[model samples]
Target: MTYLFNQPSAFAAELIEGFVAANADKVRQVRGGVVRSTRSKAGTVAIVVGGGSGHYPAFAGLVGQGLAHGAAMGNLFASPSAQQIYNVAVAANNGGGVLLGFGNYAGDVLHFGQACERLRADGIPCELLPVTDDISSASVSEIEKRRGVAGDLAVFKVASAAAEAGHNLAEVFRLAQHANQRTRSFGVAFSGCTLPGATHPLFEVEKGHMALGMGIHGEPGIKDTLVPRADVLAEIFVDNLLSELPAGVAAAKGQRVAAILNGLGSVKYEELFVVYRRVAQLLASAGVTVVEPEVGEFVTSFNMAGASLTLMWLDDTLETLWHAPANAPAYRKGSVIVAEALSPAEREEPVQETLPEASAVSQQSAQRVLLLLEAMAQQIQSSAEELGRIDAVAGDGDHGIGMERGVLGAVAKAREVAARGAGAGTLLCRAADAWADQAGGTSGALWGVALTAIGTALGDQQEPDASRVATGVRHAREGIMHFGKAQPGDKTMVDVLVPFSDHLSQAVAQGASLSDAWQQAATVAHDAAQATAQLLPKMGRARPLAEKSLGTPDAGAISLALIVNTVGSLLHDKTPV
Candidate 1:
């Protein structure tokens, strides 16, 4: 979730600082996000550009030779305020005034309109050129409501160059709008994003499903569908975009054009390229030129899982800028038609699997515990919803559901080694690693703690029995409560923990044997779990669900109770617990 280059609120300013530090000779900041060249020719219409944050190379990156005259920067996914836009227009003014080129968003319109009004007050002429190239998949009744997307690049490049060449503001706006008219784009999303330090994701599509036509800021898409493979997905995306193009604009076999394959943050290039292959073929079949397209992340939307395709019908004038030599951190190009490529970017190293750090459990007994945990994981995998509903009474409705699925995933790896049956400690160690990686949240870590504690309880018991079972359950609860910071009265698993351990301990102390004590503990845990509703959440996720939990026990405590009862039931005469 962390933004790579700079902090959030400070990003716009730092990016400008870096831009000036690197290209002081080519561009200069004018006391705002706007940057201009000192030698901008007189009478040549100035191109004022801008947009929200995160799209590093787009609004700012394009502010170089043969591109924008200057750029007005804004916050993340937010439009530049009116004053910022006015500043850019004022600095870029050469008396002949400027052409303001930007994306078509409601916020952008509101801010830019005020900036234009302010400029008119100063007697400066200004024109607004908006890019609306996203061929919205919305139905006819909904088309007017769609937002602008990636096609802004080529269209702005064309618009900016027109101004740089001494074309009047009117003509520059004309060309920019023309580009918007000729260009079309569409996108789809799979998962969602997490702003830095966020504990949960901002949005969610569905398990194994994608929402086509989703916007950049976690907004809902036109529709959700089971994600198809790259080839089939490409056909759907490209075909939709093509249908919206003017009937014959790109229908000629040799009509030279360029295609931009954009990733919506965190999508891997290989997957993007796979989808592009379909786009390339689709364009070829329809008689459009793809022109050795660039395939990489351009404009991104945080960590959302999706991508968009923007195809611009190009002429020699637009094609020249597309081929122009340029280089910026996020976007790059070389005029050279042929050359040996530079060394490739480094790949991320795979994580090595090794035993985790834990001392309570030894390598032997841990393995047997691993077998038990894995078996339990499989049993709960399909019960996420059922458990979730049970927890709904006294805990977060998701506790049962999340735990069921989370443990199953963690067990997948743990079971593999356990199937061969190693000692308890070794298996527990492996299980701990898998649980943390796959389970992902507080519950996952707690499950791992339980596994390690079981290893500790099994200690030197060569042929473990009910006594070992009771000891392990007690130790496991201790670990969960210790690190989790939730107690019995706090409406957590401790509710059942206190009763379960006490029953088993007393039974053993009063001359009861392992079988009888284990059975008593199971019965105690179930009723105690149901009793959690008597307490209010004083800690953990259940606290939020506490008031709602009134009249019911915490789901986690209940779940802990269920798990212990199950484990205890397996302990019997002449059998290892």
Candidate 2:
């Protein structure tokens, strides 16, 4: 259904280019995303919000005077890489500090959290504000696990307003948290969305039936029922939200709230207004007051035929900030005093590092590493579609594309460094960085950790032998476990990685050659990956729809197995070690 695209991989980048060109007066393009064209006060808290690229108006469109200072844009339905988030935060930072706000999805959490640590290490004060507003994703008792949806707007607005009001980083973060606590959203979809160049939708709803509690990223709904009239749908929305008022709000009666009736991409404004009509009547009947209710798209999935209702229970402070003036490209509340635009020279430029000198033996090893990366890239490209199919059973179906992008980036970077006569360790490290930067998801971050750990274990000065290679692989496993926080039974990539690492280490310790040990370990990885089909996902986006993934191997685990197997073949055929 996404008819307009040059190439699937290039879609996100191209759209961002066009977006900046059209909104140049309001925002300017940065390395990873967009920042406000106008400069803010010297010591104000900078609000940097971001997520995957499909949700327009949510991210780049909200970068302006009274909204986000900048947004780290990622590939379609994938979180931006940690490097991307860091770049945006660095560019957006005023002298005070930076507040990173994003939906509480797994990928966003991993990438943003990493960026927060990096920012602090670079002497910049940074805090995280993950929005959890979707009531359908988790139980009230498990509110922290909820997925952020349309209600992100309310939290972003209030937090940005606090920053604009000259609040310090602590105050801004506190207000953001308060706003997140007060906001609740519920969404439904008439049909699923298709990514650009895809022949089919990620998931489909039965004809004449509508999905309830569907996610914005084309995730299938938890339940399905026959389509109902607009009034009935509105009633469903009101009843669900009112039944679970936030902890502070005793009841819906006499409560003043900001309501947002959001149309997810394909839903028209007219349809939303019709739904909002009944929503308003129901609220009034329940003695609840609606304050400046907005009835249109604020956040969206790319052309998903759905809508969501968000209620932000407003306190006095929240209400004042809600009513404050804002001027973004897509969202404008009231007139704002335009600030001076930033000149080209004021923007930050990316720093390039020079390649370090390497010994002849290490340079030869780097060539072998490049060959291994190229083979892995080819394997991932060939299997991407199948991997995506498996992921769509329960999670967002972008795993294949994400892996493909990541491996291709890694291969390209490896080739560049190997040509420059870099050592094996330095080449692998650079390739890992490129993979993470290009893919920008949970898998991307985890793979980056794995490769970096391996690179660190094998120093650039010498040719790594079988024992050293085994140690590097074991370290890779440890790093992945630490970074991803998933154990073997969690049905993630760790399921495969752990077994492979252990087997390889044991075999190498018993004096097996690197090629033989790797071949044996690849078999272990394959079995572990297949065994994941019987396990339930305990982490990431697949956790909520665990039942649906019952008979399918995890996409991440499968991809890791495929890569390791490819590497094993390469090692057996060519690499001396």
Candidate 3:
């Protein structure tokens, strides 16, 4: 169980602060995450790697001389926001372009892809490389869908080495993809990890059983079986990896591979050595030679009692890059020249945003929007645990907490802006920023996009009428579908959002008032959310275990329905004809 935290919500930030304080020799705190305390050569490709923050020694811990230039760390067990990714990438970018790398998770994909687009729009070249190396997450035919596990280390190492060797952005990205393709990881957990301040673990296992292929986020594994002896466990790991050698590798015999026997949090080094001993014997018996066999924690899942084995099958270039000298806070390879640490940079002053002019009617409408947001925050807070339970059935169980945090943040910002007589558009824009910044996950990004898109459609200068509001909702739906690449049947929030938007637009066209139209649309959304229980998830993390989510609605879909319904109730009392 994890302890030692002030507020559960503030844990990731505090951990980053302490990490920077302890490793000042190697890392410095940046807006989104950490960058190298030591300056880098000009025109060198920057390798920016990150994921959720629970995996220490992975993101920030790997930011130094020859590894990642910076890491955009996210909230615990959640992906970073696009703003965070963009900020870190901007801070780390040199004359050469930036290469973004992280695990092949849905939230990471959405945020990083958005950041890449933003960077490119601003004339900074950016590329993304998602590590899909865990074989257990998906089958051989859909290998690209696998979740990245400990194999992330191998991919990040090779890409960073390529960058250090003066490779261009394209070459760095290519090498990173090569490393990811050549790597495979398999893991087993005796138990699940407990988040800080949480009373129970995310999942559980019987005393004499083990979970096979469990994710690092405490997501239940694909299979469960009786616990085996250390040697037998080693056999399981080796046989699975050996059965599916990388496509280019002819056979395991006489092949060189970089092996990482990683302990996931609670497992000890001594135990890892025991497991690796058998692993080595098995590999050697197959005429395979292991190079630079690492036996320790690389990527971890809080205090989950589990271990994983990674095999990075090496070719000439990969082997050379794998052995390159590197230095970071937690990981170090061959001796690296000591680069003098620079003093921390002064914080930049915040630029004041000019408030857009607004009409009196829109300003009045903004007050109603604020009240709706407050109600949303209250309802989300009340139902968070239930939403989390629903999400845990098929995905990482953080939806409820994430929604509560985001809605509360949005409500707070909306209240403050409304007090200043801001218009509906301005209030919603500020609230959207707050929600995305505080939430820092897939839900955050999608909600941020939806709100921002609506704000854009409804100019502050005009009164928010039923026609305008319906238009804004349609715009929001389009933006979400384009950004998230999820359709109505994908079992995402889009499932409800599409129906709600269509119903609202149709009702408004038929001369319905805003309040009445919203109430009807809310009914459509509610039904759509409920209908999701019969569909299988085809997107995001839940896609791997679609069956497990059979009878439960998607957390995002359900939350959207709840918010719409809550807002509908408020509309009757507040919206003017």
* Top candidate when judged by lDDT against the true structure: 2
lDDT of 3 by residue, 1-577 (tens): 7868899878999999999899888887777798887878889999999988888887888899989999999888778878788888988887799999999887788788888988999999999999998988888899987888899899999999999999999999999999999999999999888888989887777788999988887555678999999999999999999999989999999999999999999989999899999999999999999999899998998888999999999999999999998999888999999986665342342355467788898898788778778888999999999999999888878899899988888888888888888889989988887787678778998988888888877778877789988988899898789878999799999999999999999999999999999999999999999999999999887887899999899999999999999889888886452
| Model 1, CA-based lDDT | 0.66
What value does the lDDT take at residue 541 in candidate 3? 73
Clashing pairs in 2: none
Model 3 clashing-pair count: 0
Q: Rank the candidates by TM-score, best first.
A: 2, 3, 1
| Candidate 2, 40-144: lDDT as tens digits | 999999999999999888899889999999999998888888888988999899989999999998788888988898899999999999999999888888999
**Candidate 2, which segments miss by more than 4 Å at Cα?**
351-353, 356-361, 509-513, 574-577
Candidate closer to the true structure by TM-score (higher is better), 1 or 3? 3
**TM-score winner among the candidates?**
2
What local distance difference test score does each model get?
Answer: 0.66, 0.90, 0.88
lDDT of 1 at 22: 82
lDDT of 2 at 528: 93
User: Over all chains combined, what TM-score does candidate 1 have?
Assistant: 0.54
- Cα deviation of 231, candidate 3, in Å: 1.8
